[model samples]
Target: MVSDRRYCRWPRSSRERTCISSIGPLLQPSSDALEKQFDSWQLRITPVDYLLGVADLTGELMRMCINSVGNGDIDTPFEVSQFLRQVYDGFSFIGNTGPYEVSKKLYTLKQSLAKVENACYALKVRGSEIPKHMLADVFSVKTEMIDQEDGIS
Candidate 1:
């Protein structure tokens, strides 16, 4: 009479054990079932979109600065200064521009902004306000022009 058993009685040979161990897990059903699952993920805004947004904001601020200068609204000068600073800080985090270039541009802008602020303060302290028409005279030149005029060579 033969005994009926599911497992082998003797120790398995190394080759047999290796094959059995490798094949055993595949025979079981996994709880995760990752192979059968599906999902989708995507970004709402691409990096290009972010860069364009920054550029647009920068352009708008520049336009505002020009308008403020032309209008002689001293407060606008300060606002423009703050706006440029904010843009610089944001760009620093994004790293879209090289550090040296960005820093140079930022410093130049800041210096001009500070000059505008000081001029406005002086005018105010002298018991006079900047005329709107003089805004052009205040922020008329480009940052590069100011740098060149200042002999920043």
Candidate 2:
């Protein structure tokens, strides 16, 4: 097992430190493969399936963010944002053919992720704690919007 003390070593030179800092967080395990799978699945799945898959993936992404925080890895937030954006872009490729309910839910999900991304950006810039309430609000809004849009009223 990788020890918690095992950190990626940055170069000693000041110039190298500047370059490393500018490059941002190093990618973690399986991120590239996951993105590729997400892309391939998005292309093949039906609208309903796509929405469901995205929702599932979103949940996983959130968990990853939390884990990152717990592990003192701030870079995960940026990765989450990038993953979310890719998910959104994948959905966009499906156009207007999705069920109205799914479409609306997806939109709400996107909005919630926008909030997360903004929060992460703020955290990255100012180094703050991301509010638990914000994450809760996103999930609640997503559930409410999905139900309402799906005529579950």
What is the Cα-based lDDT of residue 33 in candidate 2? 80
What local lDDT does model 2 show for residue 149?
Answer: 62
Candidate 1 residue-wise lDDT, 1-153, digit = tens: 001111222222323322112223224443455633643222244455444444444545555555655655556555555556666666657463554544444554455455555444544563155455654654444444656767775
Lowest lDDT 10-residue stretch of candidate 1: 1-10
Could you tell me how far off, in angstroms, the CA of residue 100 lies in candidate 1 after the best superposition? 14
Best by TM-score: 2
The positional error of residue 79 in candidate 2, measured at the CA in angstroms, is 0.9
Model 2 is weakest, by summed lDDT over 10 consecutive residues, at 17-26
Which numbered prediction scores highest in lDDT against the true structure? 2
For model 1, what is the error of residue 14's alpha carbon versus the real structure, in angstroms, after optimal superposition? 77
- How many clashes (backbone atoms < 3 Å, residues ≥3 apart in a chain or on different chains) does model 1 have? 5
lDDT, candidates in the order shown: 0.47, 0.53
Off by over 4 Å in 1: 1-44, 96-132, 142-144, 147-153
